[model samples]
Target: MNDTYSNGKDVIRITDVKLTTVQTRRRTGAISSHIVLQLSTDAGITGVGEISDLDCYRMYMPDPAAVKMGIEKVALGQNAFEIAALHERLLAYMPSYFRYANTYPPFTPASQIAAGVEMAFYDIVGKAFGTPVYNLLGGRQRDRFEITYPVFQAKKESDTERYLGYMDALVAEGVTRFRYYVGVNFEQDENFLIAFRDRFGDKVQLKALDFQGHHHWKDVLRIYDRFRQYGFELLESPSWREDYEGMAELRKRVDVDISEHISSLAQAMRMIRAGAVDVFNITIQSGGIYQAKKLFDLAEAAGLKSLISTTQEMSIGTAANAHLGAVVPQLHYAGDPVGPLLYVDDVVTEKLRYDGTQLIVPQGPGLGFEIDEDKLAALQAGLVEWDRPAHGANYVSD
Candidate 1:
């Protein structure tokens, strides 16, 4: 039955689902691969979403052609606005499960397949309600939010110069907040910190992300003490992600705030209850916009601050970050939403514009950007190879 909802809006059933592979240099400085997801409704309304994944999951149907066919099988005839239902349905039928640390969310699709599907639902629902996506998630607290530029550590000299140049360019563009990966060399990390202090002075807000738990819990204090005088902002994933006791103790001892990416809302509750985190950092990768909103609400209830973390998602995924930023009341816009800033190219017709350090959240319906069909075609046609940089040195290597 293709009937209208009781709210007086016409029911828009998802009639088609399509996914495509695009080749581009992602924010992590890899000429990698990403999937663009599109959902078409019976009423002719179309929604867009995108996803990128590392080698974390090996699909039985690795070919995009086959996956697109599978998506249609799972999505066709379903209500486009039933976000949670759609998310659960997609994950309930994945060919592979999320294969990361044991502490992360379980029963999730390994790749960005679930993210793309979830984003599509948000787009359809927002368009259906004639409001921005964040409006559908209990309204927004801010009209705009801030994002940080990520500095990826590289071993090549040219890559080093390029990243430094990228930093300088961002500073010229009025970016005032930055996050640098804390590499293995403490002295080198300290050198980068000193140079950053000398270059940007106190005008810049800096955060140290140990994507790899490089330091033992006892020794972590040693490193923190050395940089404590500089007023280093935050330390993330220092020694172990699931070491809640260590993280809690560090929170009690150090001058720095601690944060790490968690897998599930239940785990977030556990982390909050254990007093393990100063800032609740969750990515859009796990459950897309709907679940991300739930996580923020949980953080708010627990009296903990929350922020959206990105794995350098492309335009659609990054736009999802801004949508989340606008609505999450407890968020400070302190996390990284540097997808457009990191990518050499994007699929959106209108590229995102930054107002100094802040990313201007698009106010239009759905994810606030239109797809560039020609650009999509060009990227799909130019597919040469796909690569993802390792996540961090200590925990999981990509």
Candidate 2:
């Protein structure tokens, strides 16, 4: 798209690029790191983006140290408003890393890189036009959205008590929905669910988000039967993430909602055809913001519910998700962009605001957060000491 604003002289050209790598700690003491992208324009406008470290998909994560030169090659000296063409160039120029995972859609780390770049470009465009990124995508659909608090697997009584404490605090602040990890120790999980319902009562909602879905459909049915009385509205990935047939079989056997991560548009379609899931959990990691919109659009067209999933991103990445959450019509349920609330510290000058369970969509000109350059520099300096893989924690449970 060409730059055509009310003022003929509003065009901005990207001049320089900077990539800052930063790491933050999750509430559970897990390390969460991101590569923050900054683009400087000739018109004195700067845009920011973030590339998050996805836990299970770490093998597919591109080295941030190596991504800068590639970004410079594709993004430098371009008209800042030609984001579509810029995105095309980015996709063609960056490495896709398709062989890292043997999954259905294949893990493409390049998409994450593209997403970071696209996020920066969208920030620049929104700033230039003096509007929020959601307005640029479409008009705002909702000012605020619901969010589900993530609670890990409770292995013992103390674990359950600790989680209950967290939930009580959140509930006092207006949070009512929670998601727990299952498929681990069934007896402990059952006990935790029982305690959870007893503590919060039926006014609160619970859902299961499992990372290990290696069980057979019959086994999954048994697990579901055990937890059915607790009133779980949804169960995500009861079978393997890509096991559409198995998921379809399970869906037929139970009335509880099922959800799967949409890695690609083709995967969503396949799942839809198989009647596998009642919901599709999408994240910016699936591609960039635009690609996520496409997947959500597809899910809505098929009459399936969708929610914005998280990769445990910090403020900037969460800001981008906030904009998506604002415009996406199918995002009817609670999203998981709990980074601003969960991260110990963030690179943004002011983290996104969280009110109870809802994350208020940023209303500023760009992705709505400013970079903390000093913090970014500090994080980069300490990168050599960290083995990211060794410090990584599970997204659902650890």
lDDT for each candidate structure: 0.69, 0.75
Q: Which parts of model 2 are misplaced by more than 4 Å?
A: 1-10, 55-61, 94-108, 155-158, 211-213, 378-398
- State the weakest 10-residue window (summed lDDT) of model 1: 98-107
TM-score of 1: 0.86
lDDT at 108, model 2: 53
Task: State model 1's lDDT.
Answer: 0.69
- Ten contiguous residues minimizing lDDT sum, candidate 2: 97-106
For candidate 2, the C-alpha RMSD (Å) to the true structure equals: 3.5
Model 2, 1-398: lDDT tens per residue?
Answer: 32433244646788999887676776656666577889998867899998775444444455665788888888888877787787678767753421122232223557677778888989988887778899888889988888887776776567778778877877887778788876557788889888888888987877555534556677888888877888877887677646789889989989878877776767777889999989988888666788788888889899999888876678888888889999988675688888887777888788898888788999998888788777777666332232454232232333
TM-score of every candidate = 0.86, 0.88
After superposition, the stretches of candidate 1 with alpha carbons farther than 4 Å from their true spots are 1-9, 26-29, 53-66, 94-111, 154-161, 381-398
